[model samples]
Target: MSTVATAFADSSIMLRRNVKHTLRNPTTMFNAVLFPIVIMLMFVKVFGGAFSVGEHYIDYATPGLLVMAVSYGLGATATAVNDDMTKGIINRFKTMDVSRGAMLTGHVVVTTVRCLVACAAIVGVAFAMGFDPEASALDWLGVLGLFVLLAVGASWLTVAMGLAAKTTESAGLATVPLIMLPFLSSAFVPADTMGAGVKQFAEYQPFTPIIETLRGLLAGHVSQGDAIAAVAWCVGFAVLGYVWALSTFKKRA
Candidate 1:
């Protein structure tokens, strides 16, 4: 078979395995759906009064929580990759006739699907909480595009972590930064409200541009600057991550 055909087959098999694993352990979906909603509710109910930046806290928080969900999902992906490595599954695959890109493509595709499902759940919960998108369908599509790009980049980074981790525990622990980044960005609150140093950092951070781009897209505004920045960050990260992960995987193999 051609390399392309082999890669396609390998990716399909890996995707099927991931889907079955997710179905068997429904907790993965449960956490992906619930954790962000819980955080949204908690923030709105507990700190809404203190941070009265908007009429409805949930409305203001929807985008941030959505991003958080995507970020947190990377941890689960990392853990799974690490487990596969530990069990010699990756090594076995390496010795097969699979294409070199198959492993990375499979994980990235699975992660993208999970990201879409989690984003849909977040939108449902947000709507239930009276959070509405003021943007048109095209704008919403733009936001979804940005999300897919971000997920692909993040999955590569997590794959590298999985390859580099000495243990499963470390692989799981490496995701803390991913989880915390949204909070530190313009996600929960505006950067201007933070201290000067933090605000400066937040303004330039990757997540800030991503969140801004999403918010603008969802709000029906034309934020070209933010849009450009978001795309730049996503593409840059994806390329860098792909290079690093491929190098690491080859070395380890």
Candidate 2:
């Protein structure tokens, strides 16, 4: 077979295996989907009016919750990688004739599927809670594209964490920063509403631009600057994560 075909076949097998594993353990979806929806509802009901950054508090939260769902999916990737490592699956794969990129491709594709499902659930819950989309279908498509890019980039970072983690708990715990980033960014309220120091940080943070980009896309507003920044950050992180993970993999092998 050609290299491309071989890689595709290997990645397909890996993706199928990962999906089966995820289906067998529905806890992954529970945490990635249910937890985010519940948290979004709780925050909207309790603190929505108190922090009136927008007319529809739930609408303001929908994008952030979606991003959180994508972020949460990274934890599953990390856990799966660690579990495979512990079980010597990585060693077995190394002995195969598969392309090196196939392993990462499989995990990334599986995580992307998980993120999409979680995102759909979040959107359904948001709609049920009366959060309507003000954007056009094309804009929504752009938002989904951005999210999928973010998911792919974040999966790489989780892979690096998985390779570096000493234990399964560590692999899971390593995603805390991803979980906390939205809270620290402009997800909940405007950066101006934060204290001066926090405002400064939030203004420049990666998640702030990402959230702003998604918000603008959902709101049908032009947000070229935020969109550019978000994509740049995503690409930068993906490259860094890929380099680091490959180096680590080589050394450990």
Candidate 3:
């Protein structure tokens, strides 16, 4: 096989192995898919009336949860990578004829796929709870596109953190800030409602544009400006994370 073909084959093998591990030890997988749904339900049931979005709280809220669900890849990837590094799995792979970059790519690919599944589950549960979005086919496609971008970007960043961490605990902690970003952004509320300082910070944060874009798309009102900003953020995250992850992995491996 050619170099590209061989690398693809190697990455596929690694991806299958990682997926099997995820199936056997499904705690992380369960959390990745279920945690956001529970949070969404809690918000919809308890705080739905209190929220300023009023009648459309479920419609407005589910997108944020979907974005949050997309972030599961980060924590999962970080833990998996850290475990492999500390548990001598990386060493074992190094001794073999595996493609060096293939292992990292496999983790990234699997995380993206997992995020897709989580996003789908979130949507299904949202429907059951009366969270109906009048989005067109194109709008749905745009939402899917943003999700893929987010999953891949987060996956790379977490992979970098995992490679950098000395232990699995620290690796898991690396995701705290990431998981917290949604709340600080315009996910649950409009950034304009925030005070001056906070509004500025919330508006400029990476998660804000993403949340806004997804919310707008789902509501059948695509804000071109926010969409551009969202795509830019995704691209920036993916590029920085990919470079950082590759460099960190090379040094560690």
Candidate 4:
């Protein structure tokens, strides 16, 4: 087989291996999907009255909550990659004829799948709780495209973090930013309502554009400018994460 085909075969094997690990560990999904739902509940039940965005509170907040849940999945991705690295599984592969990049590729692919699953779960729960987005089919398609870009960028960044960590604990810490970023962004509230410093940061940060784009798409108010910014952020993260992850994997292996 050609090198391309061999790499695909190797990546498929690695994908299955990592996916089984994720399935065996249900806590991974719990960690990835629960907090966001809890927060969603709190916002809807306790503070839902105080928030308004020209629509129902759930309608407005669902997009941001979904994005946060998906982003948080990277924490699990990072930890899993770290486990493989520190547990000598990667070194074992290095000693064999396995494709060098396949391990990371598999982790990334599975992470994306998990994130999508989390998104689906959160959306379903939102629907059950009367969180109707009222979006059209094409709009849902657009949101899905946004998620693909987001998963690509975030999973690769997680891979890079996994490669950089010296231990699994530190790997967890390394991705704390991923978990915390949504709070500081327009994920829960409008950036313009924030304090000046925070507003500026929230307006410019990576998650802001992504969340805003998701919001706009779902709400049927998408502006071309925000869409452009979101795509740019996705591309930037994807390129940067890919280069960092590939280089680090090569160095570590």
TM per model?
0.94, 0.95, 0.96, 0.96
Worst 10-residue lDDT window for candidate 1 reads: 52-61
Model 2 misplacement above 4 A: none
**Model 4, residue 3: displacement in angstroms?**
1.4
TM-score order, best first, reads 3, 4, 2, 1
For residues 1-253, write the lDDT of model 2, one tens digit per residue.
8888998999999999999988888889788778888888888888887897856888888888888888877888898888877778888888886677777778878988988898999899889889977899999889988899888888888888887888899999999999888898888898999998999999998888888899999899948999999999989778877887788666664
lDDT by candidate, in order shown: 0.82, 0.85, 0.87, 0.86
Residue 36's C-alpha lDDT in candidate 4? 72
Worst 10 residues of 3 by lDDT: 47-56
CA RMSD of each candidate after superposition: 1.5, 1.3, 1.2, 1.3
Runs in model 4 with CA error above 4 Å? none
Top-scoring candidate (lDDT): 3
Clash pairs for candidate 1: none
* Per-residue C-alpha lDDT of model 3 across residues 1-253, encoded as one tens digit per residue: 8999999999999999988977786777877888888888888889878779644888988878988897755787898999998898888998898998898998888888888888999899989888889899999999999989988888888888888999999999998889988888887878888998989999999988899899889989989999999999888888888898888878887
| Candidate 1 off by > 4 Å | none
Tens digits of per-residue lDDT for model 4 on 1-253? 9999999999999999988988898788687767678888898779878866667888878878877887777778888899888899999997888998898899989988888887888888888888767568898999999988888888888889988899999998898988888889888778878997999999998888888888888887788888999899888878888999889888877
Clashing pairs in 4: none
